[model samples]
Target: MSKTTRATQALQQAGVPFTVHAYAYDPNAERIGLQAAEAMGVDPGGVLKTLMVLVDGKPACVVLPSDREVNLKKLAAALGGKTAQMMKPADAERITGYHVGGISPFGQKKRVPTLVEQSAFAHEEVFMNGGQRGLQVKLRPADAVSALGAQVAELI
Candidate 1:
């Protein structure tokens, strides 16, 4: 058996039910979320992407629908922070120990506060990156929050 990645290992430890989907790499793919949705045969709306943002000068994670972009003002309000800004890719990599396309809300190298868009709750399961490129995990939104100790909010 192959060694599980940090994301998978965390899910297993937390007893969060999930299914792994793997697909061939398309070098031409532009958006990570779209790639995952296409590869997993799921609706773009049902796929969520993890974004790193700095809220009030603190690193935070925002999980949003793949089809939409994060609204910084709404995110700031949801987080009760004065401001929210996108984190630099290098800073994100340093904080999560994963590249931009492979960043998972769970099992990050550092425990940063996280918020998931409330829309995600409507879906039975959401597809998100599995700590590696070309791999994604299908899991309940609630389970994801529990695993990551994240807060659910209207962050769209």
Candidate 2:
């Protein structure tokens, strides 16, 4: 698979160091993130999933451990919003300029407030979608936080 992607380009532009990894993407998998972790032979917690959400009807991005689930109430509270809900797949794709399974927090068509799970900082590096299916970018969580201007919180 080609290593170049908007996500990778964004990282490069930001001067953030990262490594690109390619894995078999399974569209049929019940859980895409866990499937990625298993394919990469890495801990699930170190594989971050990018989610498109609407906080008070405004687009937002959320990054968290593959093995964890977001608590919408907690997420909304953390963002100082009254409600949070996952964006419809079509809307997510439209907003992020990526397919449902290939959305990455970086290089989205629209820049939105981003929230990253605080627990992700436990790892020296974590993997996230590289703006395409079958591709991942591994980078320091700190770098990602800075690059995305992401708020770190207990979103799980």
Candidate 3:
């Protein structure tokens, strides 16, 4: 079944071509990103996991591949900040208008500064959370950067 989300709506409005993917979410899965990749039959490298982080006390997003973890020091340096840390799940949910396991860089409640890992562009398409659990949005890496107004960095 296909449905719309704030993210999908934004993509459409931006004239960004994309495909919606819906899957049965298994709450028991140990890793949401990996599970999403497995469920969608895509490479983990093509799946981006959006992380909410605080760079020098301000909110920001780091979009990186599911197979990698954000290097906080490097990200902070790239953003010209003294320190960076992951936002708490509750704070992240409250800020992004998305649940912990389904945060997307698009359609966020607040326009937080965002950094997209340069490695994401290595793939033709990226599969990322679609503003909700059990759904993902597929789009070209360039489209994602344009849509999010993100800066490219070596975040991972």
TM-score of each: 0.94, 0.98, 0.96
The residue-by-residue lDDT of candidate 2 on 39-94, one tens digit each, is 99999999999999999999999999999999999999999999999999999999
Q: Write the per-residue lDDT of candidate 1 for residues 1-156, one digit (tens) a residue.
A: 122679999999999999988865465787778877887777999989889999999999999888889889999888888899999999999999987788988789999989999999889988877888777888999999899888888876
Q: Which candidate is the best by TM-score?
A: 2
Ranking by TM-score: 2, 3, 1
lDDT of all predictions: 0.87, 0.94, 0.91
Off by over 4 Å in 3: none
Clash pairs of candidate 2?
none
Residue-wise C-alpha lDDT for candidate 3, range 71-154, written one tens digit per residue: 999999998999999999999999999888878888999998899999999999999889889999999999999999899999
Give candidate 1 regions above 4 Å deviation.
1-3
Candidate of highest lDDT: 2
**Candidate 3 clashes between residue pairs 3 or more apart in a chain or in different chains:** none
Worst 10 residues of 3 by lDDT: 1-10
Clash pairs for candidate 1:
none
